[model samples]
Target: MYLTFITMIMTLVGTASSASFSAPNKDLMTCTIAVGWMGVALGALSFVALLQLRVYGYINTFIWNRKPTGVYFIAPIIYIISMSILYAILSFVLPLNGGFVYNNITNTCVAQNVIYYIGLTFMIIQTVVLCLLLFKARTIDSCFWEFRKMLLVASVGILFGIIVLAIQHVHFGDDKVAVKGILVIIFTLLPQQVYFYTILGPPVYHLLRHREYYLHEFAAIVEEKGLAHIYELAGGCPLGEISDLSDSGKPYRTTAVNRLSNDSNFSGNEPAPEIGAPLPRNSNPRQSGPLLSYYKSLWNRASRNN
Candidate 1:
């Protein structure tokens, strides 16, 4: 549940950041929106399942022969097809009344039923898949340990939450207001708290520490494409400023073509100059920064060794 919520929030953040920082191509925008909608659907379904579990003491699961194939396999196929059609209809309808009609549509009986059924299906499928993955994770290769740890942490947190809810159901008997309040706090709030510390916190800190790397890479791409103007248009500092602060250095220019043409010592098909050829004397002054100098030195050393 917490994983789905985090996924949805991250998707929204990624989409918004992409739009703000650059002009996404049509295909990129389409893919981004598709991922965002899928996350939203999953998050919504998880929330609904929690509520149903709270009310009914059990979640409806579609099992056959004590296996979860129906939950893990058939449900996802149905969800993808249904959501594709549903989103197509929504895209056509959403703009018809400046979005006011969305309120009415959401309030309708058909909409409520669809939400209920789809949410139930999604929750069951996700829960079953998560358990299966956790069971299989122990035997997976060591290369997957990082991912396995994350899954294990989240799965344990969610399982703990389920157990707490069940205990409350057995002890409190649904009639006491005080017990109801306790149930809400334990079931709704505790799991999110657990997830934050165990699953979400470390990556967020790592991203904050290394954010400059992402900015540097973006600036390098912009410089390569001669799209510095686009960065300015997006309300970012000019590429020169970013390059100075991030020390990304100028993109490399090949003197190979010029050297090949001019050097009388070289034949037409002498295998291209080794990759670590020294920069021309006329190379950009800005490329004299530490980042480029280090790379150049490393390359020259490798070429000499070869």
Candidate 2:
């Protein structure tokens, strides 16, 4: 549940911080594609970090399964590679430049294809992962499955767009005027400009709002309060399982107790994380100290040495 909340917050941050600013020399289409890829990288990094937490049995939520879903890691990898190739092919096969090599404000159709495909690929990967999530819910309790509801909303939008692209690829043979126009506008506008902007940067967004480190807070809270007790109170779900903390759209379902969170355990016995089992740092520089300050520190050392 915490991770899911963090995910949504990260999406919001990505949308808020991402600028439409482009390089003067680089095509605007490519620029947009590059920005989209950055978001994908950010999302992938976040997924990997959370997956690591699961592997280490750090989470106390209940929605997660007993075993770390290898799917969590596998899906993202396949999606990124497949999407990259798809984007590359689309860029060359059907130019988004109004069917001309250089008719639109951006570069040739191929460049636009490259840019649009990156976003499209992200959309597809998100959808597939979400669908897998939805299916996994049937095996768990309703309370543990609700967090995925918001995930469903985000995934649905992406899936809808992918369906459109698939049909366009078939009917118009992947390069028809109506299909390309409809696709570029749909992907770049609806989900790209709005939906994705809303869902891609939840962790950063949460930090921006709280002005405190969330990951640290989660660990600290678990340490101070004791995750084992929390787990027992949370219904003794199991090690490495998260409970669903999603709402049911009912008045009775809005409370935190009703929300099902995934239940993964912290240290079970012998020793606790507080005695000092801090999760190793993952090196996300954005939230870290200033790079300029680091450079300054290094330069001072160099001057002294000279």
Candidate 3:
């Protein structure tokens, strides 16, 4: 599947790089437009594979979650749309007549109103969303956003190039490809940054921030004592979904802390009750060990329920 996708991209690139054959720019333009729309055709299959990976990487199959688990997840949909639009432009819009350089019209106009305009718009949107996701990722876990870190940097460069391209479009009206010098620098120099943030960044962020308990400096601090007291203090807000841990959901956080009330007494054949119990600091130095053990036992039972 991956090979096929690459081949398709190559075919388009072949048509796009008009320095070719007995074929004229018009023929190359016609083929390129036709080839690019193949992305939309393959979008369903690609979407399924990506969705499965996201689901499997998250909680188990027994669990149900929303369509998108995190903000960074937005990148894929944007990519799909961008590819679709970009290919459509290349395949149908044919060659651009001209382009701009800063405020100067470097190339003369070729196509009427270039479809690349739409493709460029999609690319800009994708780049912006990716940057925002990377910037906000530091809140969950510093390491969680690592995958996007490079992408964010790359997106900056890509966006700058796009801006120059857009400036060309403004000046020259998309007749020819503009920013050749800059695109040459960017497309090769920062490909990894582009690919990494788009593909590898989100999952890395999720894995890094997967568990709140794993992050809290207090987790290590309390481990020296015992597990129950730790849970007693911290078990309320689940480590399950860090995305759900935002400050905006004050009620949910409150409910999480107070969830024991929902399952106060063990009811089903599920298991025995082992809920975490809160304790007063000064009042329970002696009880800490046993209490920690109790909470740990409860956590084990709850894990079975989930």
Candidate 4:
């Protein structure tokens, strides 16, 4: 958690510094320093999440008796170690142009090529391993699906940026590629920042503010509903059939409603209740299940406490 907080602070600092020093006539050393800081901060932030995920899995296994597959435990450790080694090697090998006078264009280009290749290699490896680990974990637990999707989107954006940088490096002689690559990177950074905040910010905030409450609520729901039903509640499509019904310009009825109406238990020609209407008093608890019940209880508790 301290690492996460530090990462956020570093990211903000780096972004601000980059924006301030991004002018065409800006000192190259300053720009490089800002970029390097941002890179290290983001890299650390990325691995911190992996460590957290591993910790979460350990908790699930020991406390909840919900053991994730072995791969979930193993893959993250491998990725963290591999990435750490790669970063260490790159740090030693890559040259930082710290406002120094380069003797020639050749030396500058060589440094640029080394940094570009090292960064690109790290990105490729990180993307592949992280995606695989997340995907595998998602298969083991549906709750991770959102995390998997968000990470995949971010990875694709990064892969695109890396490709642009690669092109820039390969055509080092062409000023056009360098300009295009810089532009692409700037364009990509905005969306990636938005993605990070939009997808991750709320959950992190909630965890920080209501950590105990959130955990208790989750445990209650999982206990009450059973894991399979909880999974469905998390991932199920409540309005999935709405699109099909919309094409025919008919009011959408849920499968549950149709089944109830057809049964001897409910023999009314009366119109089905509105989509968002509350269920009847005698409605099956199994339909809505514990997830909904947990939310209601949580809301009531909050209201009372306030």
Best of the candidates, lDDT = 4
Give model 4's TM-score versus the native structure: 0.46
The candidate, 3 or 4, that scores higher on lDDT is: 4
Task: Tell me the lDDT of model 1 at 131.
Answer: 57
Name the lDDT value of residue 155 in candidate 3.
Answer: 51
> Per-residue lDDT tens digits of candidate 3, residues 8-62?
3543343233212223433434334332343222331232233223322222211
Can you write out model 4's per-residue Cα lDDT over 1-306, one digit (the tens) per residue?
334445555544444443233334444454444444343325433534443354344234323444444775566556565654555445444555422122232222122455545655665665565555455445444332345545555565556555645544465453353454455446445434554564455445555566335434443433343343323222223211111111121222222223223333222233433323333332444234333343345456776886
lDDT of 3: 0.36
RMSD of 3: 12.9
TM-score of 1: 0.32
Error of 2 at 82 (Å): 8.2
Rank by TM-score, highest first.
4, 3, 2, 1
lDDT against true structure, model 4:
0.42
Instruction: Looking at model 4, report the run of 10 residues with the lowest lDDT sum.
Output: 239-248
Clashes within 3 Å, all models in order: 0, 45, 17, 0
Q: TM-score for model 3?
A: 0.36
State in Å the error of residue 177, model 1.
Answer: 1.4
- TM-score per prediction, in order, is 0.32, 0.34, 0.36, 0.46
